[model samples]
Target chain A: MSVVARLDEARAARRQKALIAFNATTLRLGGKTIIENLDLEVRPGEFLCIVGASGCGKTTALRLAAGLYGPTSGAVTFDGEPITGPRREVAIVFQDYGKALLPWRTAAGNISLALEASRVPARERSSRIEALLRKVGLPGHADKYPTEMSGGMQQRLQIARCLAQEPTTLLMDEPFGALDAMTRQGLQDEVLSLTQTSQTTVIFVTHDLDEAIYLGDRIVGLLPHPGRIGIELAVDLPRPRDQLATREHPEFLRLRRQLFDFIKATEH
Target chain B: MNRAAILWRVASILVAAGFIAAWQLIANLRLVSPVFLPGPDRAWAALVRGFSSGDLASKLIGTLEHMAYGWLAASIAGIALGALIGSSRMMRAYVAPSLEFLRPLPVSAIIPVAIAMLGLTQGMALFVIAFGAIWPIMLATIHGFAAVEPRLYEVARSLQMSRAAVIGRIALPSALPDILAGMRLSLTVALILSVVCEILAGLDGLGQWVLLSARAFRSADLFAGVILLGATGYLTSIAVSLVEQRLLAWQTAAR
Candidate 1:
């Protein structure tokens, strides 16, 4: 390697240190530790997935990253600054879309909530909301209420609302768990493309191993009972991943097997 | 709209007609003295006479004003205090016990106390009606606001919503169904208390009109005043139901 190439590589490595970090984070609730002495770093614009068993505190970790909860004994930081509370540039998509959505608000109204919170002017709101709705494949359904939409459509509406914030990082807590097989696959690809184009860092938490392998740049497997990282793998699957070709890839299969084994072991 | 619904409506009309016929028969047979139990014809005649003479209209207006003012005051106070107490864990802990202690005490028991404090005046009647009506609305508001889904709060936090915005945009909308239910119950309470207070305070309302007619041995007039009061209660409740239906249209749509 040439001297100039080495210098460029070192600079890139330093820049990739962390956008969000949980430094020795420990969270206790109701006299029981939920997450214990954890350390995790997420690179900027990386799609990181955390996959584990049911009681592995994966959602709790996502909540911590979203700054919805404070760690009991350690620090969670974003952009090298300690996160004290929720920020405008960080949007979270919850698993229970029904509860997360305002039932009274229409689809357009729901997406406008993030814009309203950001204090975007009223005139600019409608146009921006139209673009978001179109982007999420919910065009011309703006006036429809969340109750009127299918489960898959409602989840898509939720993503649109989150995207309205134009977030730097997106935190998703098992968002596809309630969806059907076909709907989940469609959403998986939609989210992948959305985040890829926006270059938004994502920390997606789920129990499905194949989903983690398909969408993540890096995958973290968590252990239950005082939740901590059990295994970590870097997915080298080619980008612009195809649902068929990517899952069929040898690397993807190997990572899926490794995660499945880790999850099964945690059950014991 | 449907077979069952049409059948129910027809059944209700038949029941009302049967009641009136039975009442008229008892009067015609002289089972009760005319002075004690007037016929439906006499009652209906008295209603026409009172309304045409404009006496009953003014009395109705007075009673409605009292009920409306009292109900409005109760609604405002109940929702404000409920939002405050329900949104805070500390407030719920501190005030909930006192509220529980006071809630079950029959509102009628407070009539004499209200009369003693405010005297025999419209103010006393207003106070009594408001005091009686406030409980259901306030309790409902508290329950509604407190029972808001926890996930919605998380969404608010993620959106970086302020405390006021959370209460206004999220908590208020979520709690509206409960609040509206409470208000409907409160409206009935307001109407009942309005009559009671007007009777006790000798205020210019249907209650006072009925009491005066009884003293004068005008049984038909007394019955007419009562029918008018019943109609008022029915109409007001229907009005509240209409408002609730409009506000909670989404709930029904979801179903």
Candidate 2:
């Protein structure tokens, strides 16, 4: 009945209606256990960031969620259904932008790849591709090859191509890891606004603590050597986050510090 | 063009000129018997005569037609099989040994077998050309497809693209640079094999013309035919390289 209780109730409902969840997932790759007894729940429209030191299997976990890889045991589910393979509505943006986009395809052509995958009618593809490019702040760059663009621009182009799928969930694997700091921040804000406006659920994997706090509605830190969730922190930062004010906010600083300490402790 | 490119071009022309001048000097001074190797001028005169009499034109057309058809057939067959083998681990395992076994046997060796089957006809020449040309293309395409970054395949799978679509869009384009390079290599092989086939079978081609002129002791005509073969090989390679440039301009620009 109280404001706090009402908010708690809303949170419970969101948890119940999770968009993607990993249930006691175990994954073995090349005879080595990569992930063990991992459980995660991602609510619809929630911006969740997974963070850890290198080899923590955060990206592997994201891959499990995207159905790019199946678990060695247990299940990854979407909307209460088991995920056996990549779904058209679930799109991934890889960290290696150089390898992700087709070198032969122009920026527009790259976006058109997703459109074509989803089987959007040819007549509607041009306008949709244009709109996605505009959304990602890459207007008029349709003709530019991925190799010709700057790292930041290429990342944006990648994001635009993913958006062309009009995916319900965006799974990014350290998508901005290669960008310069300024460009990283710029893309962070752009991604925040775009995901916010689209109301798409996001499961972003990054090693950066500040990035986890800045963009995530919740943060999940995985401990390495058979990766499993060690900490789960809810970020209550205000929406429409500002680059200057949001990072400087007390709660954001607290979360960032906590995540950093957790990571530092886990590194050993 | 950059200074280096222009300088290289000039350097190449100078090298050719120097070689020709030396050959002329050797023949004019009778340093080597003219019967063994005719002078450049004598060869040129024979080339003019052959063209004017239209013997060279008809032979050149026959060679060109055979090379073109054989090259095209090999390209298509090689690419299709290479893609199949490249895409499947099972297919690669099953097919690779036979491919390796067949690849190393010289095309010249196959000429006798082809003659036994096809009886020294044009079919025999076509068979040799196609068979010889296919290996480079197939192997290169297989290597290219296998070398595609694993992440790209992940991207394709994540996009939920159909198997056919994945091969058509991702596999083929990613392999294109290597494919074109292979095609270039195969073009040379095709030229060599076609000429070899012509010589061995006495078929109607530049190779046959050279053989007949040599037997008849017409050194100038023999030298001219050999020169034309070298020139044709050089020109065809240049044409393929131009096409490769046009198709893979993005690759060059990206680099």
Candidate 3:
């Protein structure tokens, strides 16, 4: 049985609020179709990963979901309301975390820039920033500038900065794709753990199939040329998954191969 | 900023003093005329005498007031116009050719017309100085705005900040360093224009004093006026630089 079917059989039944829903969405730019007829629904607090090739509109779809821009056609609803332009309930973490986090600001101040922008009260902001920094294992480094920190620390700071909004839905566009392997592993675990605590719905984009399967509750695949949903694979792996066990799991390898084949097939 | 740097600075000063001493020896031996060429000591005495007699003290206030007026006018005009042009390509296109045409014409070339219209007034000098200084400030501000990275704008867009907020926060801060650099360049134009205008018109200024002494063949006083003018130019730049450093503390650290 498939992961979803097996999950359904184990649970017997299920009902939950939909966090994000996209219906017959078509995104076009200058006569070129990017995402066409993409329809999907994400459950509340689910860790969803999107896997696709370059120029398959994965980033564009993520942008639409975040409401940076509206769909060229059809609807993308977040928390049951049609998204228009950047919602306060939503926050996006980018591939270039360095640029998104203000360089001039210290690690704590960088995180606070978002809060200040949002008009979060002063005392609460400081306490929240302190908590977030410590949560990211960057307690003493709070006063250090972004330039003074390492690549991994910078990425972690970006995560902390995004979390300043206390956002319900976190849209990340290849957040870990730029990091070194060790740093990537550390951050993936940090993000995964934090997602559990915050119950933040995650719609993450990546080209890495293994990463998609490793981190996602459901791995979404997209085909190129007016990109449409190709495969929807639910990851039924147990929680509190150790990195080694998760990577070495037979099911993980099987799902990874399946996603790899989907992407490889598209090149032909 | 440091002990080693201070020592090196003093060493350079000592070297300059020795050169001046050699010049004094050469001039005293009649290789140069005291009428045409005054040595460092003579010029220094002339400066001291001028200061004590208040030849320079009163004139300096008037000159400084003129510079401030011109500097403020240029800053306001350049930043406002440059920002408008920078924000709109159509405005840039319409004005750019005209600016390019005007930028090359020496500001000093307008001295006669300025004198005719304003009649040797401080306003005339201020007008000339502002005209001379504004071109670089405008160009730099425009370039700074135009050259902002596309992704930064994407961040602002994603934040859903209002257009005005984006300009006030992101655009202004991002353009600040370049704007300061433009101010530094324009500082030169302001000082030079003021000096040139002062000399041409009947004025109570260091420049006017220098011209008056030059005609009277009071070489030491002329040289002293020249030295004082150079000092003022240098000091104005240094003051702006200090202000730049304080205001742009974030920028300096990034670099």
Tell me the tens digit of each residue's lDDT in model 1 across A21-112. 99999999999999998988888889999988887889999889988899999899999999898898889999999988999999999999
Output the worst ten-in-a-row residue range by lDDT, candidate 3 chain A.
A8-17
Worst 10 residues of 1 chain A by lDDT: A2-11
**lDDT value for model 3:** 0.83
Scored against the true structure, residue A24 in model 3 reaches a CA lDDT of 92
By DockQ rank, best first, the candidates go 2, 1, 3
lDDT of each: 0.91, 0.89, 0.83
**lDDT, candidate 1, residue B227?**
96
Best by DockQ: 2
Query: How would you encode candidate 3's per-residue C-alpha lDDT over B155-252 as one tens digit per residue?
Result: 67766667887777777777878888998899878877877778877777777888889999999999888888788888999999999998877655
Native contacts kept, each candidate: 0.81, 0.83, 0.32
All DockQ scores: 0.78, 0.80, 0.50
DockQ of 1: 0.78
TM-score, prediction 3: 0.93
User: Model 2: per-residue lDDT, tens digit, B1-255?
Assistant: 999999999999999999999999999999988888899999999999999999998888877877887898899999988888987878888989999899998888888999999998988888889999999999999888877778888888988889899888999999999999999999989988878888998888988898899999999999988888888889999999999999888887666
Could you tell me which 10 consecutive residues in candidate 2 chain B have the lowest summed lDDT? Answer: B246-255
Give each prediction's root-mean-square deviation over alpha carbons: 3.1, 2.4, 2.5
What does the lDDT read for residue A185 in candidate 2?
A: 96
- Per-model clash counts, in order, read 0, 0, 0
